[model samples]
Target: MVIMTATEPATAGTAQTETGTEIETASDAGTAPGPGPGTGSAPGAPAGPVRPVEALLLVDLQSAFVAGGEAVPDAARVLDRSRALLARARAAGALVVHLQNDGAPGTVDEPHTPGWRLHLPVAPGPRETVVRKTGDDGFDGTPLGALLTDAGVEALTLCGVLSEMCVSATARTALARDFRVVLPHDAHATYDVPAAPGIGESVPAALASRAAEWALGDDVEIVARAAEVTFTAARPGCGTGSRAGSRTER
Candidate 1:
Protein backbone atom coordinates (compact mmCIF):
# COMPACT_ATOMS: atom_id res chain seq x y z
CA MET A 1 0.00 0.00 0.00
CA VAL A 2 1.39 3.42 -0.95
CA ILE A 3 0.87 5.68 2.09
CA MET A 4 0.84 9.24 0.77
CA THR A 5 1.06 11.94 3.46
CA ALA A 6 -1.07 15.01 2.70
CA THR A 7 0.03 18.46 3.87
CA GLU A 8 -2.34 21.32 4.60
CA PRO A 9 -2.19 24.08 1.98
CA ALA A 10 -0.73 27.21 3.50
CA THR A 11 -2.82 30.38 3.27
CA ALA A 12 -1.38 33.90 3.10
CA GLY A 13 -2.98 34.66 6.47
CA THR A 14 -1.60 31.59 8.23
CA ALA A 15 1.73 31.36 10.06
CA GLN A 16 4.03 28.82 11.64
CA THR A 17 3.97 28.96 15.45
CA GLU A 18 7.14 29.12 17.60
CA THR A 19 6.80 25.35 18.09
CA GLY A 20 6.85 24.95 14.27
CA THR A 21 3.16 24.02 14.16
CA GLU A 22 0.90 25.58 11.53
CA ILE A 23 -1.62 28.01 13.11
CA GLU A 24 -4.26 30.44 11.96
CA THR A 25 -3.02 34.02 12.18
CA ALA A 26 -5.11 36.95 13.41
CA SER A 27 -5.54 37.99 9.79
CA ASP A 28 -6.88 34.52 8.93
CA ALA A 29 -9.63 34.66 11.54
CA GLY A 30 -12.68 34.85 9.24
CA THR A 31 -15.38 34.26 11.81
CA ALA A 32 -18.61 36.17 11.24
CA PRO A 33 -19.95 37.26 14.62
CA GLY A 34 -23.49 36.31 15.53
CA PRO A 35 -26.02 39.07 16.21
CA GLY A 36 -25.80 40.41 19.73
CA PRO A 37 -28.69 40.54 22.18
CA GLY A 38 -31.79 42.29 20.77
CA THR A 39 -30.15 42.56 17.38
CA GLY A 40 -30.96 39.62 15.18
CA SER A 41 -33.67 37.91 13.16
CA ALA A 42 -37.26 38.07 14.40
CA PRO A 43 -38.12 35.99 17.43
CA GLY A 44 -37.95 32.28 16.66
CA ALA A 45 -36.68 32.97 13.15
CA PRO A 46 -33.41 31.63 11.83
CA ALA A 47 -30.97 34.25 10.56
CA GLY A 48 -30.06 34.48 6.87
CA PRO A 49 -30.15 36.88 3.90
CA VAL A 50 -33.97 36.79 3.46
CA ARG A 51 -34.16 37.61 -0.21
CA PRO A 52 -37.81 37.92 -1.26
CA VAL A 53 -39.00 35.78 -4.14
CA GLU A 54 -40.82 36.95 -7.23
CA ALA A 55 -43.78 34.84 -6.20
CA LEU A 56 -46.39 36.25 -3.85
CA LEU A 57 -48.74 33.55 -2.56
CA LEU A 58 -52.06 34.89 -1.39
CA VAL A 59 -53.79 31.84 0.06
CA ASP A 60 -57.56 31.36 0.56
CA LEU A 61 -58.38 35.00 0.01
CA GLN A 62 -61.75 34.18 -1.44
CA SER A 63 -64.64 36.65 -1.72
CA ALA A 64 -66.45 34.64 0.92
CA PHE A 65 -63.80 35.36 3.50
CA VAL A 66 -64.26 39.11 3.26
CA ALA A 67 -66.50 41.55 5.08
CA GLY A 68 -70.30 41.28 4.47
CA GLY A 69 -69.68 37.74 3.27
CA GLU A 70 -68.85 34.62 5.30
CA ALA A 71 -66.61 36.88 7.39
CA VAL A 72 -63.09 36.13 8.49
CA PRO A 73 -62.78 38.30 11.60
CA ASP A 74 -61.41 41.75 10.75
CA ALA A 75 -61.48 40.88 7.10
CA ALA A 76 -61.60 44.53 6.19
CA ARG A 77 -58.20 45.19 7.72
CA VAL A 78 -56.75 42.07 6.22
CA LEU A 79 -58.16 43.11 2.89
CA ASP A 80 -56.65 46.56 3.18
CA ARG A 81 -53.21 45.23 3.95
CA SER A 82 -53.47 42.55 1.30
CA ARG A 83 -54.59 45.10 -1.24
CA ALA A 84 -51.56 47.22 -0.50
CA LEU A 85 -49.30 44.20 -0.77
CA LEU A 86 -50.87 43.19 -4.05
CA ALA A 87 -50.34 46.63 -5.46
CA ARG A 88 -46.74 46.66 -4.38
CA ALA A 89 -46.05 43.20 -5.71
CA ARG A 90 -47.77 43.97 -8.96
CA ALA A 91 -45.89 47.19 -9.40
CA ALA A 92 -42.68 45.26 -8.84
CA GLY A 93 -43.75 42.74 -11.51
CA ALA A 94 -43.92 39.94 -9.02
CA LEU A 95 -45.97 36.91 -10.00
CA VAL A 96 -49.24 36.87 -8.10
CA VAL A 97 -50.97 33.59 -7.18
CA HIS A 98 -54.42 33.34 -5.65
CA LEU A 99 -55.51 30.15 -3.92
CA GLN A 100 -59.23 29.35 -4.02
CA ASN A 101 -60.97 26.75 -1.90
CA ASP A 102 -63.58 24.57 -3.60
CA GLY A 103 -66.39 22.99 -1.68
CA ALA A 104 -69.09 20.40 -2.54
CA PRO A 105 -72.01 21.46 -4.66
CA GLY A 106 -74.56 23.89 -3.18
CA THR A 107 -72.05 24.84 -0.47
CA VAL A 108 -70.07 28.02 -0.16
CA ASP A 109 -67.13 28.23 -2.58
CA GLU A 110 -68.69 25.68 -4.90
CA PRO A 111 -67.53 25.83 -8.48
CA HIS A 112 -68.51 29.04 -10.27
CA THR A 113 -69.96 30.44 -7.06
CA PRO A 114 -69.17 34.03 -6.12
CA GLY A 115 -67.75 32.75 -2.88
CA TRP A 116 -65.17 30.77 -4.79
CA ARG A 117 -63.81 33.83 -6.51
CA LEU A 118 -60.81 35.83 -5.39
CA HIS A 119 -61.68 38.93 -3.40
CA LEU A 120 -61.61 42.17 -5.35
CA PRO A 121 -59.27 43.88 -2.95
CA VAL A 122 -56.49 41.52 -3.90
CA ALA A 123 -57.79 40.23 -7.17
CA PRO A 124 -55.39 38.69 -9.65
CA GLY A 125 -54.61 40.53 -12.85
CA PRO A 126 -55.29 38.98 -16.25
CA ARG A 127 -51.78 37.54 -16.29
CA GLU A 128 -51.75 36.41 -12.67
CA THR A 129 -52.48 32.78 -11.78
CA VAL A 130 -55.25 31.20 -9.73
CA VAL A 131 -55.04 27.74 -8.20
CA ARG A 132 -58.03 25.83 -6.83
CA LYS A 133 -57.75 23.15 -4.20
CA THR A 134 -60.16 21.00 -2.20
CA GLY A 135 -57.86 20.70 0.78
CA ASP A 136 -56.38 23.22 3.15
CA ASP A 137 -52.91 22.67 1.73
CA GLY A 138 -52.89 24.60 -1.55
CA PHE A 139 -50.58 22.07 -3.16
CA ASP A 140 -52.95 19.19 -2.43
CA GLY A 141 -54.52 17.96 -5.67
CA THR A 142 -53.50 21.16 -7.40
CA PRO A 143 -50.84 22.39 -9.83
CA LEU A 144 -49.56 24.99 -7.36
CA GLY A 145 -46.20 23.32 -6.92
CA ALA A 146 -45.81 22.81 -10.67
CA LEU A 147 -46.67 26.42 -11.30
CA LEU A 148 -44.13 27.67 -8.80
CA THR A 149 -41.51 25.20 -9.92
CA ASP A 150 -41.94 26.15 -13.56
CA ALA A 151 -41.69 29.79 -12.63
CA GLY A 152 -38.40 29.17 -10.76
CA VAL A 153 -39.71 30.36 -7.39
CA GLU A 154 -37.69 29.34 -4.33
CA ALA A 155 -38.93 31.81 -1.70
CA LEU A 156 -42.57 32.82 -1.07
CA THR A 157 -44.35 35.58 0.79
CA LEU A 158 -47.71 34.43 2.24
CA CYS A 159 -50.79 36.48 3.14
CA GLY A 160 -54.47 35.55 3.14
CA VAL A 161 -57.44 34.18 5.11
CA LEU A 162 -57.93 31.54 7.79
CA SER A 163 -54.52 31.94 9.35
CA GLU A 164 -54.75 28.75 11.36
CA MET A 165 -56.32 26.71 8.60
CA CYS A 166 -55.61 27.22 4.93
CA VAL A 167 -52.79 29.76 5.21
CA SER A 168 -51.01 27.81 7.92
CA ALA A 169 -51.46 24.53 6.07
CA THR A 170 -50.13 25.90 2.80
CA ALA A 171 -47.18 27.60 4.50
CA ARG A 172 -46.17 24.44 6.31
CA THR A 173 -46.48 22.40 3.13
CA ALA A 174 -44.47 24.98 1.24
CA LEU A 175 -41.70 24.83 3.81
CA ALA A 176 -41.77 21.03 3.73
CA ARG A 177 -41.21 21.26 -0.01
CA ASP A 178 -38.09 23.41 0.65
CA PHE A 179 -39.61 26.75 -0.29
CA ARG A 180 -38.67 29.71 1.88
CA VAL A 181 -41.72 31.21 3.60
CA VAL A 182 -42.34 34.82 4.67
CA LEU A 183 -45.26 36.05 6.75
CA PRO A 184 -46.12 39.74 6.97
CA HIS A 185 -47.87 40.00 10.30
CA ASP A 186 -50.47 42.43 9.03
CA ALA A 187 -51.36 40.73 5.79
CA HIS A 188 -53.33 37.72 7.05
CA ALA A 189 -56.48 37.12 9.06
CA THR A 190 -58.68 34.37 10.62
CA TYR A 191 -62.01 33.96 12.39
CA ASP A 192 -62.76 33.09 15.99
CA VAL A 193 -63.76 29.46 16.20
CA PRO A 194 -66.36 28.59 18.78
CA ALA A 195 -65.53 25.91 21.30
CA ALA A 196 -66.88 22.42 20.67
CA PRO A 197 -67.65 19.59 23.03
CA GLY A 198 -64.45 17.97 24.37
CA ILE A 199 -62.48 20.37 22.19
CA GLY A 200 -61.01 23.62 23.42
CA GLU A 201 -62.83 26.85 22.61
CA SER A 202 -61.71 28.52 19.46
CA VAL A 203 -59.19 31.27 19.98
CA PRO A 204 -60.05 34.88 19.16
CA ALA A 205 -58.94 36.34 15.86
CA ALA A 206 -55.92 38.20 17.28
CA LEU A 207 -54.93 35.23 19.36
CA ALA A 208 -55.31 32.86 16.45
CA SER A 209 -52.98 34.99 14.35
CA ARG A 210 -50.44 35.04 17.14
CA ALA A 211 -50.77 31.30 17.60
CA ALA A 212 -50.24 30.63 13.92
CA GLU A 213 -47.20 32.92 13.89
CA TRP A 214 -45.73 31.05 16.84
CA ALA A 215 -46.74 27.67 15.47
CA LEU A 216 -44.88 28.51 12.29
CA GLY A 217 -41.85 28.88 14.59
CA ASP A 218 -38.52 30.02 13.16
CA ASP A 219 -39.29 28.69 9.71
CA VAL A 220 -41.58 31.56 8.68
CA GLU A 221 -40.08 35.06 8.62
CA ILE A 222 -42.44 37.67 10.09
CA VAL A 223 -42.23 41.28 9.06
CA ALA A 224 -43.66 43.97 11.32
CA ARG A 225 -45.93 45.57 8.75
CA ALA A 226 -47.00 44.69 5.26
CA ALA A 227 -45.61 48.00 4.04
CA GLU A 228 -42.12 46.89 4.99
CA VAL A 229 -42.35 43.97 2.60
CA THR A 230 -40.29 44.00 -0.54
CA PHE A 231 -40.89 41.59 -3.44
CA THR A 232 -37.32 41.42 -4.66
CA ALA A 233 -36.04 38.29 -6.35
CA ALA A 234 -34.32 35.70 -4.19
CA ARG A 235 -30.57 36.31 -3.99
CA PRO A 236 -28.00 33.67 -3.17
CA GLY A 237 -27.78 32.56 0.49
CA CYS A 238 -31.05 34.29 1.33
CA GLY A 239 -33.74 32.95 3.65
CA THR A 240 -34.29 34.76 6.98
CA GLY A 241 -32.73 38.01 8.32
CA SER A 242 -32.71 40.61 11.07
CA ARG A 243 -36.35 41.60 11.52
CA ALA A 244 -37.23 45.29 11.56
CA GLY A 245 -40.57 44.56 13.18
CA SER A 246 -41.85 42.69 16.20
CA ARG A 247 -42.19 38.90 15.95
CA THR A 248 -45.35 37.11 17.04
CA GLU A 249 -44.30 35.08 20.08
CA ARG A 250 -47.93 34.16 20.89
Candidate 2:
Protein backbone atom coordinates (compact mmCIF):
# COMPACT_ATOMS: atom_id res chain seq x y z
CA MET A 1 0.00 0.00 0.00
CA VAL A 2 1.25 3.47 -0.87
CA ILE A 3 1.12 5.82 2.10
CA MET A 4 0.58 9.58 1.79
CA THR A 5 3.29 11.62 3.39
CA ALA A 6 3.13 15.28 4.45
CA THR A 7 4.54 16.53 1.17
CA GLU A 8 3.30 13.74 -1.07
CA PRO A 9 0.35 13.82 -3.47
CA ALA A 10 -2.87 12.71 -1.71
CA THR A 11 -5.29 12.57 -4.57
CA ALA A 12 -6.34 9.39 -6.39
CA GLY A 13 -3.14 7.50 -7.05
CA THR A 14 -2.40 6.39 -3.47
CA ALA A 15 -4.05 3.24 -2.12
CA GLN A 16 -3.99 0.47 0.47
CA THR A 17 -4.56 -3.28 0.19
CA GLU A 18 -7.51 -5.53 1.13
CA THR A 19 -5.99 -5.70 4.59
CA GLY A 20 -8.11 -2.63 5.44
CA THR A 21 -5.29 -0.46 6.80
CA GLU A 22 -5.14 3.32 6.10
CA ILE A 23 -2.03 5.48 5.60
CA GLU A 24 0.19 6.59 8.48
CA THR A 25 2.84 9.23 9.24
CA ALA A 26 3.70 11.97 11.76
CA SER A 27 4.65 14.35 8.95
CA ASP A 28 1.09 14.35 7.61
CA ALA A 29 -2.18 15.08 9.53
CA GLY A 30 -0.60 18.37 10.70
CA THR A 31 -0.26 17.66 14.45
CA ALA A 32 -1.46 14.17 15.43
CA PRO A 33 1.97 13.42 16.90
CA GLY A 34 3.74 10.17 15.87
CA PRO A 35 2.51 7.79 13.21
CA GLY A 36 -0.36 5.61 14.34
CA PRO A 37 -2.08 2.73 12.53
CA GLY A 38 -3.73 4.61 9.65
CA THR A 39 -2.51 8.08 10.49
CA GLY A 40 -1.85 9.74 7.16
CA SER A 41 -3.45 11.65 4.32
CA ALA A 42 -6.42 10.25 2.42
CA PRO A 43 -6.34 9.67 -1.32
CA GLY A 44 -10.05 10.03 -2.11
CA ALA A 45 -10.20 12.73 0.56
CA PRO A 46 -7.56 15.13 -0.59
CA ALA A 47 -6.67 18.16 1.47
CA GLY A 48 -9.27 20.92 1.00
CA PRO A 49 -11.79 18.34 -0.23
CA VAL A 50 -15.35 18.47 1.03
CA ARG A 51 -15.65 16.36 4.20
CA PRO A 52 -18.32 13.72 4.86
CA VAL A 53 -20.14 12.88 8.04
CA GLU A 54 -18.80 9.43 8.80
CA ALA A 55 -17.14 7.52 11.62
CA LEU A 56 -15.81 4.11 12.65
CA LEU A 57 -17.36 2.41 15.69
CA LEU A 58 -15.50 -0.45 17.37
CA VAL A 59 -17.61 -2.38 19.84
CA ASP A 60 -16.97 -4.77 22.73
CA LEU A 61 -13.24 -5.35 22.08
CA GLN A 62 -12.71 -6.12 25.73
CA SER A 63 -10.04 -8.25 27.32
CA ALA A 64 -12.78 -10.71 28.12
CA PHE A 65 -13.15 -11.34 24.42
CA VAL A 66 -9.54 -12.39 23.93
CA ALA A 67 -8.19 -15.96 23.91
CA GLY A 68 -8.76 -17.61 27.31
CA GLY A 69 -10.91 -15.97 30.00
CA GLU A 70 -14.43 -15.34 28.74
CA ALA A 71 -13.19 -15.71 25.17
CA VAL A 72 -14.97 -15.29 21.90
CA PRO A 73 -14.12 -17.91 19.25
CA ASP A 74 -11.85 -16.81 16.40
CA ALA A 75 -11.01 -13.82 18.58
CA ALA A 76 -7.48 -13.58 17.16
CA ARG A 77 -8.87 -13.22 13.68
CA VAL A 78 -11.32 -10.60 14.84
CA LEU A 79 -8.56 -8.70 16.60
CA ASP A 80 -6.32 -8.72 13.55
CA ARG A 81 -9.04 -7.35 11.30
CA SER A 82 -10.18 -4.88 13.94
CA ARG A 83 -6.68 -3.56 14.39
CA ALA A 84 -6.41 -3.12 10.67
CA LEU A 85 -9.70 -1.22 10.59
CA LEU A 86 -8.63 0.97 13.48
CA ALA A 87 -5.32 1.89 11.84
CA ARG A 88 -7.12 2.82 8.66
CA ALA A 89 -9.71 4.87 10.48
CA ARG A 90 -7.03 6.79 12.33
CA ALA A 91 -4.99 7.28 9.20
CA ALA A 92 -8.06 8.79 7.61
CA GLY A 93 -8.63 11.04 10.62
CA ALA A 94 -12.14 9.69 10.75
CA LEU A 95 -14.13 9.92 13.94
CA VAL A 96 -13.64 6.70 15.91
CA VAL A 97 -15.43 5.34 18.95
CA HIS A 98 -14.63 2.32 21.09
CA LEU A 99 -17.60 0.77 22.88
CA GLN A 100 -17.01 -1.63 25.75
CA ASN A 101 -19.39 -3.79 27.73
CA ASP A 102 -19.73 -2.90 31.36
CA GLY A 103 -21.02 -6.27 32.35
CA ALA A 104 -22.89 -6.76 35.61
CA PRO A 105 -20.71 -6.71 38.69
CA GLY A 106 -18.92 -10.01 39.42
CA THR A 107 -19.13 -10.96 35.78
CA VAL A 108 -16.15 -11.10 33.42
CA ASP A 109 -17.04 -7.71 31.94
CA GLU A 110 -17.44 -6.01 35.30
CA PRO A 111 -15.89 -2.50 35.20
CA HIS A 112 -12.15 -2.11 35.87
CA THR A 113 -11.56 -5.80 36.26
CA PRO A 114 -8.54 -7.17 34.38
CA GLY A 115 -10.84 -8.92 31.95
CA TRP A 116 -13.03 -5.86 31.58
CA ARG A 117 -10.29 -3.64 30.21
CA LEU A 118 -9.96 -3.10 26.48
CA HIS A 119 -7.77 -5.66 24.79
CA LEU A 120 -4.30 -4.22 24.19
CA PRO A 121 -4.44 -4.72 20.44
CA VAL A 122 -7.54 -2.51 20.19
CA ALA A 123 -6.45 0.24 22.54
CA PRO A 124 -7.72 3.77 21.88
CA GLY A 125 -5.59 6.90 21.75
CA PRO A 126 -5.92 9.86 24.07
CA ARG A 127 -8.13 11.69 21.59
CA GLU A 128 -10.32 8.75 20.69
CA THR A 129 -13.66 8.33 22.51
CA VAL A 130 -14.41 5.26 24.60
CA VAL A 131 -18.06 4.62 25.49
CA ARG A 132 -18.89 2.16 28.25
CA LYS A 133 -22.16 0.25 28.24
CA THR A 134 -24.12 -2.55 29.92
CA GLY A 135 -26.38 -3.26 26.95
CA ASP A 136 -25.92 -4.87 23.56
CA ASP A 137 -26.93 -1.86 21.50
CA GLY A 138 -24.14 0.66 21.75
CA PHE A 139 -26.57 3.53 21.36
CA ASP A 140 -28.88 2.25 24.06
CA GLY A 141 -28.75 4.62 27.03
CA THR A 142 -25.18 5.52 26.18
CA PRO A 143 -23.50 8.72 24.97
CA LEU A 144 -22.68 7.01 21.68
CA GLY A 145 -25.32 8.68 19.52
CA ALA A 146 -24.62 12.07 21.00
CA LEU A 147 -20.94 11.64 20.40
CA LEU A 148 -21.52 10.69 16.79
CA THR A 149 -23.83 13.65 16.36
CA ASP A 150 -21.26 15.94 17.88
CA ALA A 151 -18.72 14.64 15.41
CA GLY A 152 -21.23 15.17 12.59
CA VAL A 153 -21.08 11.49 11.67
CA GLU A 154 -23.90 10.50 9.37
CA ALA A 155 -22.56 7.06 8.48
CA LEU A 156 -21.14 4.52 10.92
CA THR A 157 -18.72 1.68 10.14
CA LEU A 158 -19.22 -1.15 12.63
CA CYS A 159 -16.62 -3.73 13.77
CA GLY A 160 -15.70 -5.61 16.94
CA VAL A 161 -16.41 -8.66 19.11
CA LEU A 162 -19.38 -10.99 19.33
CA SER A 163 -20.66 -10.27 15.83
CA GLU A 164 -23.91 -12.03 16.67
CA MET A 165 -24.64 -9.85 19.65
CA CYS A 166 -23.19 -6.37 20.23
CA VAL A 167 -22.26 -5.85 16.60
CA SER A 168 -25.73 -6.94 15.52
CA ALA A 169 -27.51 -4.77 18.09
CA THR A 170 -25.43 -1.69 17.33
CA ALA A 171 -25.89 -2.04 13.57
CA ARG A 172 -29.66 -2.27 13.99
CA THR A 173 -29.77 0.74 16.29
CA ALA A 174 -27.52 2.73 13.99
CA LEU A 175 -29.88 2.03 11.13
CA ALA A 176 -32.92 2.94 13.23
CA ARG A 177 -31.26 6.20 14.14
CA ASP A 178 -30.96 6.95 10.40
CA PHE A 179 -27.20 6.70 10.14
CA ARG A 180 -25.87 4.71 7.22
CA VAL A 181 -24.25 1.52 8.55
CA VAL A 182 -21.51 -0.59 6.97
CA LEU A 183 -20.31 -3.95 8.25
CA PRO A 184 -17.09 -5.17 6.71
CA HIS A 185 -17.52 -8.96 6.44
CA ASP A 186 -14.12 -9.82 7.85
CA ALA A 187 -14.11 -7.11 10.47
CA HIS A 188 -16.58 -8.60 12.91
CA ALA A 189 -16.80 -12.08 14.48
CA THR A 190 -18.43 -14.27 17.13
CA TYR A 191 -17.62 -17.55 18.86
CA ASP A 192 -19.04 -20.99 18.20
CA VAL A 193 -22.25 -21.19 20.16
CA PRO A 194 -24.03 -24.11 21.80
CA ALA A 195 -26.95 -25.33 19.73
CA ALA A 196 -30.39 -26.29 20.92
CA PRO A 197 -30.97 -29.86 22.14
CA GLY A 198 -31.88 -30.89 18.60
CA ILE A 199 -28.99 -29.13 16.85
CA GLY A 200 -25.76 -30.08 18.64
CA GLU A 201 -23.06 -28.90 21.03
CA SER A 202 -21.66 -26.06 18.93
CA VAL A 203 -22.34 -23.71 16.05
CA PRO A 204 -19.39 -22.70 13.85
CA ALA A 205 -18.11 -19.15 14.32
CA ALA A 206 -18.30 -18.55 10.56
CA LEU A 207 -21.92 -19.70 10.58
CA ALA A 208 -22.81 -17.33 13.39
CA SER A 209 -21.11 -14.42 11.59
CA ARG A 210 -22.99 -15.27 8.43
CA ALA A 211 -26.27 -15.40 10.32
CA ALA A 212 -25.62 -11.98 11.83
CA GLU A 213 -24.63 -10.60 8.46
CA TRP A 214 -27.83 -11.91 6.94
CA ALA A 215 -29.91 -10.60 9.83
CA LEU A 216 -28.38 -7.16 9.28
CA GLY A 217 -29.71 -7.53 5.74
CA ASP A 218 -29.77 -4.82 3.10
CA ASP A 219 -30.10 -2.08 5.67
CA VAL A 220 -26.52 -2.66 6.68
CA GLU A 221 -24.28 -2.75 3.64
CA ILE A 222 -21.58 -5.39 3.93
CA VAL A 223 -18.06 -4.97 2.58
CA ALA A 224 -15.66 -7.86 2.07
CA ARG A 225 -12.67 -6.18 3.67
CA ALA A 226 -11.56 -3.17 5.76
CA ALA A 227 -9.09 -1.58 3.33
CA GLU A 228 -11.96 -0.90 0.94
CA VAL A 229 -13.58 1.31 3.58
CA THR A 230 -13.03 5.08 3.69
CA PHE A 231 -14.38 8.08 5.64
CA THR A 232 -15.26 11.50 4.21
CA ALA A 233 -13.08 14.34 5.36
CA ALA A 234 -15.05 17.10 3.70
CA ARG A 235 -18.79 17.87 3.88
CA PRO A 236 -20.73 20.73 2.30
CA GLY A 237 -20.78 22.91 5.38
CA CYS A 238 -18.16 20.97 7.31
CA GLY A 239 -15.57 22.65 5.12
CA THR A 240 -13.45 20.98 2.47
CA GLY A 241 -12.65 17.94 4.59
CA SER A 242 -12.26 14.28 3.65
CA ARG A 243 -14.59 11.31 4.20
CA ALA A 244 -13.95 7.59 4.63
CA GLY A 245 -13.93 5.14 1.70
CA SER A 246 -14.46 1.46 0.84
CA ARG A 247 -13.67 -0.69 -2.18
CA THR A 248 -17.20 -2.12 -2.24
CA GLU A 249 -19.13 1.16 -2.16
CA ARG A 250 -19.60 3.16 -5.32
CA lDDT of every candidate: 0.63, 0.61
Clashing residue pairs in candidate 1 are 50-239
Q: What tens digits encode model 1's per-residue C-alpha lDDT throughout 203-231?
A: 67877776776676555666655665668
In angstroms, give how far residue 96 of model 2 lies from its true place: 0.8
Name the candidate that leads on lDDT. Answer: 1
What lDDT does model 1 reach? 0.63
RMSD for each model, in Å, please? 21.1, 13.8
Cα-based lDDT at residue 15, candidate 1 = 25
Clashes of each: 1, 32
Model 2: per-residue lDDT, tens digit, 22-111? 222011001111222242534333223212336888888777787575677677777887787777777777777777677888998776
TM-score of 1: 0.70
Residue 109 lDDT in model 2?
A: 74
Candidate 1: worst-modelled 10 consecutive residues by lDDT: 1-10
